[model samples]
Target: MMASSDPAVIQTRALSKRYRTVAALTDCTITVPEGRISALIGPNGAGKTTLLRLLAGLARPTGGDIAVLGTAPRPDPAFLAGIGFLAQEIPLYRRMSAADHIRIGAHLNARWDGTSVRQRLEGLGIPLGQAVGTLSGGQRAQLALALTLAKRPRLLLLDEPVAALDPLARRQFLAHLAEAAAGGGLTVLLSSHLLSDLERICDHLVLLAGSRVQLCGDVDALLAEHQILVGPRKDTTAIERDHTLVHAVRTPRQTTLLIRRNGPVIDPAFETADVSLEELVLGYMGQHADGPSPAHLSAIGGDQ
Candidate 1:
């Protein structure tokens, strides 16, 4: 978890977006500290894309407030220069070659580093002169990433960047992404459904489900705060009274629960165990699959 003293690179308070008949996001409040690789995970249509669009200044929020790098996101050159956004489709000119894209990037971006980007593509064995349309899906994804990184943006936003790639290609893309993030001075908010992949490189977590943030915090701290309790099928009144229940399952003779521990579980009937990242995420998702209960909404973790 980031210390309270650390400066926030991204902050949102009661952020929301609506499209007439549909609400894309609602009351999302989270703070991402500078230089942290944060994972934004949620099921499809959970407003992950809408949130990224809002952060990138591509779309305006219907309500609430947002701040990126100490100011609201805008379309101005200075603000755009400090942020890079790569949508799921990996927008690029398919008719143009990789070199051509680099040339265009240099002209459009004030802080472009075409030399480094070209070298990166060359090192990957990607043909710089070939049209991007002829390249593999993996190659195009890499080229888009390289161009985005070359801008030297303070914040990077990626929306399901590797969803269409093969396993090996996904691994390769993440390796390159990990390398870039290791250089410091970069704050990344990556949206992906691959929990295992996100766990490998992300320290901070923002879980959006049912069009709202269910959990947002440091992965380690969140893990430590939650526990799985397995016990005989019995009345849960006492357990519920002592802890914040995130999810529960009951069989004929056993009852298992995922709970945010409030204090010591002094009851001898229940056995406690640590929860994994996947378990924690699924538990919360299952709990809020229909929509968050009033109690669950009030107990959301992390800032706001």
Candidate 2:
């Protein structure tokens, strides 16, 4: 478990990114502490990729600031050596064999650990002599991950790395990731739409909707701060005055409200229940479908 006092490995303030007429991200701010695997999730066109690109220093932000490893990202050798980024496409030479790629990595990366990475691939029964193009999708993904891990970066940023893998492959990929993270000294920011998979390996969360941050916090802290309230259908003016209403659904006789507690719900009218991570994420995403108000867009915990 990561403690609250852990130093931040990633921070952004009022970050904005625009591509011609479209705004990819707007006034986004977030913080990720060291030694955490954070899930970055949002709907399509919500700027998840843009954020990852900016953090990796592949693209510059149009406005605001971003810091990774306590300094602004740059293309210098030291900065590049400290972080490993695997884009969604999983860039690799299709014509090259796994052994050929390993040799290339050894020459290109100063900290390359080809021996360990090759051993890992061999243990998985991934043939070293086979051309990468002929390998299965899972094999290619694993190969890419192994190469990235070979660099031994302190921070790893992945953009939908496993979206194309089947269920068993995804499970295997996540298991490998979990094993790597268990060694400590590594921080990962993974962008994926699979909420259940994220829940299994991530302890931190950064949720984006409407091209802005909707929620950002430690998983346990966020869950502890939110709850579901069920009661008879009626005007919620009084309730609204006290809590941050994340989502509300009303039926003929009853109303269910998911809320971020401003304080304890002492009102006898509502019965409280625990909120699951999937339910919490869905509520925030649904609430922001029509554009979230300023009041609802605040970061839940950590630096804003």
Candidate 3:
């Protein structure tokens, strides 16, 4: 892999994949800026994992292109060294201690930092002598993360790293990851069904649906461009036509609308309500949630 000075750590163009009659991804394009956490979200089978695997070099795209750190996901040792991935399913050695698995990371990774790993593990208070198979689900997840972080990869590809963690653990893990992104210039692409979990940490959000990107942008800026208003049901028709209705609820005499519009404070018919990041993401995925439920809510090891 050839290194460049560009800050764009991950970039893709028209990326797609298909399996027989199923189209898993179609014309997917996204850019993850350097030094920030980017959340890749979508409804079940919206191609979140498919796109992630393409970037991680674990699976080949059926069509289209992908580049990590300005080079194709080829078998370049240098390129591989620049990235560390924690799969949705735990990938640690079942018989090994947390410490042993970390040793593997040190042996295999080009940029592995022993001191960093020790410090992080010590900070987390993860017992190193126990076998990974014996630990609880959340502990195992932290062990997996420890192995990845010890490598000190420039680009971190995590597929729901915190899904199995408890609320406190989840918060702690993401807080550290966010700090790493802020201080180490680490670029992360994480996919999860829990939008609220990422709300406070991630800088950018990407929503995928129907095998394509529905929206992608800075979280704060994106919300600013969209607003929610609630008022008499009589205003529904006008609100739907003039602004994008992300989601809406109707009561006997009042209707609530989450619209993508900005400008002026001059709406006498409806009252505006600020939407949280969770509401914003749920708004986009709500359209597809009615079809077959969501494949996203299923945990990583369910029925495995």
Clashing residue pairs in candidate 1 (N, C-alpha, C atoms within 3 angstroms) = none
Report the number of backbone clashes for model 2. 0
User: RMSD, each candidate, Å?
Assistant: 1.9, 2.5, 6.7
Q: What lDDT tens digits, residue by residue, belong to model 3 across residues 95-179?
A: 9987787678778777777677667767888778888899887777766766777777889899878887899888778877776
lDDT of each: 0.90, 0.88, 0.75
Worst 10 residues of 2 by lDDT: 295-304
* Best prediction by TM-score: 1
Q: List where candidate 1 sits over 4 angstroms from the true fold.
A: 1-3, 290-304
Best by lDDT: 1
Evaluated at residue 221, the lDDT of candidate 1 is 82
Residue pairs with backbone overlap in model 3: none
- Give per-model TM-scores: 0.95, 0.95, 0.84
User: Which rank order by TM-score, best down to worst?
Assistant: 1, 2, 3
Ranked by lDDT, the better of candidates 1 and 3 is: 1
